[model samples]
Structures are given as structure tokens and as C-alpha cells.
Target: METVRTRPGAGRQGGSGRRLTRRQAVGALVAEAGGSPLRRTMGVGQLTLLSVGATLGTGIFVVLGQAVPQAGPAIVVSFVLAGVTALFSALSYAELAGMIPGSGSSYSYAYATMGELIAWVCGWCLILEYGVSVAAVAVGWGQYVNELLRLTVGVTLPDALSAPPGAGGTLNVPAALIVVLAMAVLLRGAKESAVANTVMVTVKIAALVMFCAVAFTAFRAGNFQPLFPLGTAGMSAGAASLFFSYIGFDAASTAGEEARNPQRDLPRAIILSLVLVTALYVLVAVAALGAMPWRQFAGTEATLSEVLVRSVGGGNLWPVLLSVGAVVATTSVVLTVQYGQIRILFAMSRDGLVPPLFSKVHPTTGVPRANTVIVSAFIAVLAALVPLGSLADATSIGTLFAFMLVNLAVVLLRHRNPDAPRSFRVPFSPVTPVLGMGFCVYMLFSLGADTWIAFAAWMAAGLAVYGLYGIRHSKLDHGAGPQEGA
Candidate 1:
């Protein structure tokens, strides 16, 4: 409907640029051919499930195994600490989602207040958060699938081929396959994806509850002795790790432009999902720690399913069932991540923040087919080639950095447009935003050196692309002048 220019387009550099109304942001983005895949009922409850599907994956099943060993039994405290930080940022996001009410997520928020450059950086961060996370989740899924195969089919794959290069494995076929599979499912469009996502979410939660119920019998208070024997250093590290588990809190904002009533529903979805996810995380952490020794959680080949087996006297069909649930859980998260990527790219493309190709919609599926394939292929390669630990850390850094931007954007928007019809506002105003910023920065710094290097390189690559193309063809330069002026 519009074109973006390098220097300054219609609105700024003497051209007639159009500024969309609040209603238009949500409805217009969905008006491609037949409509956007994101425009669906997805009320608060479904949106909460979306967050759960995304948040409850590797963080609990695989990553927790590593975090538990790092922090000992105090991992419970780590989960809570990380949840607090997420809550702070979620509150800020709710406010912004109410005001902006669009799908760009951090990208749209940044563009609204921080100008063009920062928005591109946020969009780049989202690429890492969504794009890389899909691959990472797939890698975890491949592990679950291999475990399920051995349990059900009575056959085992060689570890040399099962793991990634980081883990001394050659090529992760299962990981790549699942990524492709998720892509196929997503190609069917959002409604179908949401239905599948909901079912997977139910299975994952039920599986978690089953673990808690059965594993309870093996609980021993002594298992938690010297809870902080590793001291503050270990617990802090665990907290940092636990922080990644809460990464999906902001996923709700990416749907802002598509919500049935974004101003109202977006805020509700963002906050409600955060609360549900955090509580679920705390309960899961409590159950796992109470049932086993702190040191045993280094995570076996099967991870969470292994906990059920080793700690819960699991040998019968229960372990198999739990493994199935984990496989479904990880798969659902990958789907959700991919869906978010499409919508974000749609926003950026429409705004000319990136290549317009990302915004192209498939006539059949009403989905971003080309962009989805491109992102999926890239993730498959990453999953097949990279190390899980490094991927996990990189995903965490990307997410934390985005949280920082969302929090700051909330405060700046409130100040810049106090009269805007914000359906929700953060409870503490300046304090909440500042607190959110501090928490994200702390967690961002806690990442390992390797993660820092990968993050820096990923960002540099994004900058190069933006400079080469996006800067010259951006919509912000032309449209969206002072609120009153347009």
C-alpha cells in the first residue's frame, strides 16, 4: 500500500505519507489476500497457552537439568528470581501492547519512540530470539524424538549422529527433520497452527502434572540439604540460566497487531500469560528439586523424561508417555516461535524495515510462505550444525536484550503521547520501566563470553544488511510524523 525511501520518504522529506489509525494497525495488517493468519479469536486464554507453549519448552525440560546442577537445590529460588524479572518486563509490555496494538512486537515499539536505527536493532534481536530459538527448540526436540524411538521401537541411533557438532555428534538429522516438519505444519496457516499448538500445550501441561503427581512418592527432604552449598555464585548463575526459561513472556506482544481487540486483549494476554507461565515454572522447579538430589540433574540423554524414570520409579509406559509429551511440547514451541517470526517479518516488511519479500503472503495458506521457508531452512541448518549450549545462551541474550527495549519503549511512549488511548498502563510508571531495564541488563551481562561473541557477530551482520538495504527503503522516513501533524 506504500513505499519506504532511503533518505526520507513522503511524510518527512516532502512527500505525502500516510499514518494509520489505531484501528487500522490491527485490521489493516490482516488484510493481505483473504486476511492475515494472525487475525483470529485468540482471546486471553488461547494467548496464555501460546505463551506457555513457547515458554515451557527447553527451559524446563532440558535447560533446567543444567541449571539445577549449577545452583544446586536453590534452583527454586533461581526460578522465582527469574520470574520476578519477567514480571517487571511483562507489565511494561502490557502497557505498550495496549497503546501500539500491533504485530511488530519490539520492532514496532522501538519504531514508535526510539526512531529507525533502534527499531532495526530490535528487529535483529527478534531474529535471534525467534529464528535461532526455533532451531534450538528443534535440537531439543530431536533428542526427545530419539529417546522416544528407542523406548517404543526398541532401536537406538548412534550418539555420534544424534548430537550436534558441539556435543561430538556429526549431523543432527532428527533436529533438521523436526524443523522441516514444524515448517510444514505452519504452512497450513495460523488457525490450524493455533489448534495444534493448543493440543500440544495441553499434553505438555498434563505431562508435567503427571510427573509431579507420580514423582512425589520419591520425594525426600534430605535431598535438598545444603541448598546453597554452591553459595551465591552458583545460585546467581542458576538464576541467569533460569532467566532464559522465562523468555516467552513477551511473545504475546508480537501478536498485538492481530488481536481481536489489541488494546484490551493484548494487555490481558501479555500479563495473564506471564503469570501463568511463571507459576507453572515455580511449581515444576519445586517438584523436580524435591524429588531428586541436586547433583543428579545434569540431565541424562532424555532429560525431563529421565527424571521421571530415575526418580519416579518410571519403567513402564509412563516414561514413554512423558517422552512423547516432551517431544510434542518442544515441537509446539518451535511452531509458536516460527509463527512469531512470520508476523514480525510481516510488520517489518510492511514498514520497509527489511526486505519486502518477508511480508509476502501465500494466496493459498494466507501465510508468509516464502519468509517461513527461508527462516525454517536457516534454523534447520543451525540446529544441525551448532552446539545446544551455545544456541541456548544466544537465544537468552537475544530475548533479554529485547525485553530491555520493550521496557524502555513503554516509558518513552507514555511520556511522548500521554493523551494516547492506552488500554493498559504499567502500574509503577517510571519505576517499573527502570526496574525492568536494570533486570534485563543484569541478565544480559551474565551470559558467557562465547554467547557474547555470537551475539555481537549476529548483530553486526544485521547492521550490515540494514545499512545495505533497509535504511534506503524504510517507511518510517516518509510516514508517521508528529501525531497532531498528520
Candidate 2:
């Protein structure tokens, strides 16, 4: 174990009373006194599947329809564009995850490289990104639940119970219910949750493969004629929207403390998961566009299932089976994404950035029981009341902001500590991270004004909370002795 000390009077403001300096040492952030409280049971394979499970469902099953209306048949181009953007950030994430393996993900990275204030802001953005993303994914899950009901029972829940208000229904019961179910699974233990996610990921991948097989059978070249029906601006907007599809790729980094081999496995899982997800997204988009006209996707809720239904005719088993697969797919997404949210809060809480309750891991399960329940409950309420599109856009903006910080953190960390050992490194260093930041800014600008306003409001609230609680209770502020074992 090694000890690193900050400069004298580090937390004190300078003469100008504006610049406040308090950065957590990277060594202290990664090191725990004995070992991490969270169980280290996940391997590279399960870690990759965790990311896959969190990402594969929502975008393809739900947001694809929303994006198609923006880009027409060129939505495939949008998927590729979004993937490229994610690749840049993914490289940065890989580098950081390997260098500083911790459960805080970007938040802890920012704390080590940037200062505590900026770190708090980054953590706040993650709260928005992961928490609301769980809600957004859960909302999508409700749509598939309704589809499954219609296919099997031949009767679906009424709009009031199946949809969010103004979208036709007063409350989304299925959406909230799915969150509760995921919460229960999480309470059981990390290994159990990972195993469940792996099974669901397998089923979802097989379902998409089945969809492509059947969808390609009905492929019509004519449907793609006016590929840029909505033009370049539309394509950009579509790409911004589709960026949400790639949100879960970096999720593996959040399991830093819980990974069997964080230095090696975290980087491998992040990059591998992103590649697999991007390929699946592009293939599914092509199959969907070739089989159905772009205009028809505008307002479709269960786009994939409907595509199968129309392609194979209404009276077939394919649509029914696809709906079942979707239900499983979305369920897996809710489970994994919710798990990410819980872990992030656990990290923040341990640092005294949030309430202590979140950091309390259950003795037997090695899970944060209270944190899981609270986060899941809040997400369920949001999923029940909020529309999917609004939740998705908000989540994208928050995630992009947090990712931009991660990219910047990579540059800062490399400049500050060039000799730090890393299992993975971004090939181009500063250039790659700079490009990642640029892409993030470009997508951030593409989002609507409303989303920006919401983001600003959320950031303001976070600052207030930090000022009132986090600033005083931070372990660094209190001089909680150095952590052991970097």
C-alpha cells in the first residue's frame, strides 16, 4: 500500500474565492481498506452480456420507430453515425476503466482528474443518465408487455393502464411492474442477476436474428429508394436520437469493483459489447427498412413485432413469438440498467455525495438493498407517468454530458499521470479523447431545446444538493485517511 497526499490547504478557496481545489487521489479511489464490499463475481463474458442486455432492447424494439420518422430509410446511416461517436468515447472509457478501476465509473474518474465540484456534477449527470434511462427502458418494456398480451390472450390492458398520460393512458402499470420485478432480482445477489441477464441476452439476440431471417425474406429494394427523404438535418437528428441506443456499452465500467479482473476484463467488455451492439443495431435497422416502408414506422410502438406481423401476414406464429422475445428483451434491459443505477448510487453514497443508505450493502447478498428499492421505486414512478420520448431525450443529453466528462478526464489523467499502469490505452491519446468530446458536443447541440432546458434544471438541482450536503460530508473534505491497495 502507498499513500499520496494532496497539496497543503487543497480544499480551501484561493484569493479570488472562486477556484476551489479538492481532488481525490486515483489510488485512494481504486483502493479499498481490505477489498471491495461488492462481490467480485463477474467475468469478461458476463460483463459483456450485462452491457448487451442493458443496450439491445430499448433502441431496436422502441426508439427505432421514433428515429425512423426523423431519418426516413437512412436510419441505418444514423445507427452507424451514433456507433462511431460511441466508439470514440468507448476508447476513452476503456482507458480510464483499466487505469482506475472503481464502481464510480466516470464520476470517480472526474474526481481523480478534475476536482470534487466537477466530480459531483459528473455524478449528478450519471444519476440522470442511469436513473432516467432505467425509467425510459422500463417504459419501452411496457409496450412489449402489451404486445405479448395482445398476441397470447387476445386482449390487452386499456390505455389508462398500459400507457403514460397524454400518450393515451393515465398510468403505465406494466412499466412500473417490470421495475419492481427487476428490483426483486437485484436483491437476490449480483451473480444471480448476471446469470439472469445472460439468459435474457441470449434470447434477445436469437430473437433479432430470427427477425432478420424472416424480415429479409420480405425485403424489397424499392423501399429504400429515397434514402434521405428527410435530408441531412433529419439524419443528424436521427443520429442524436439513436445515440441513446449506445448508452449501455460503458455500463461494464460501472462494475469496476465487482469485476473479477477489472484492469483487463472491464476494457475488453466495454469495447466488445459496443462492437456487438453496433453490429446488431445496424443489421436490425437494415432488415427493418428493407421489409417495411420508412414512413410506416413513424408512430409505431412495437415496431419489430409489427414488422414481423405485416411481413408474414397477421395470422402467423412469428409475430406472437417475436412479441414474447421482445418482452424478454425489454425485461433484461430494465434489469441490467437498473442494476447499473444502483451501483453508481452505491459508489456516490460511499463517498458521502448522496445519502448513506445507498452505500449500505446487505451482509448476506452483498447488495445495497435500500438503494435498490429506492431507485427502483423512483424509476417505476417515472416510467408510469412520463412519456418514453421525453425520458429518452433527457437520458441521452445527460449521458452525453457525462461521457464528454469521461473523455476530458482521460486527457487530464494522462497529462497528470503519464506513467500510470493501464491494461488498455486509447491509441491516439489526446486526439481520440478530443474527438470524443467534439462528437458529444455535436450530438448535444442536435438535441431539442426542451431537453437542454431540462438538463440545466437537473444540473441546478444537483448543485443545490451538493452545496447543502455533499460539500460538508465528502470523505475527502473530512480527511478520511488514505485507502489501501491501489
Most accurate candidate by TM-score:
2
Please, what are the lDDT tens digits per residue for candidate 2 over residues 245-323?
Answer: 7888878888888899899899999999999999999999999999998888876764787887877665748877777
Which segments of candidate 2 are over 4 A away from where they belong? 1-20, 69-73, 163-171, 221-237, 293-302, 314-316, 385-392, 481-486
Instruction: Please state the error at residue 407 of candidate 2 in Å.
Output: 0.6
Model 2, position 141, has a per-residue lDDT of 76
Computed on alpha carbons, the lDDT of every model, listed in order, comes to: 0.75, 0.83
Candidate 1's TM-score: 0.87
Which stretches of model 1 miss by more than 4 angstroms? 1-38, 158-171, 222-234, 295-302, 385-392, 478-486
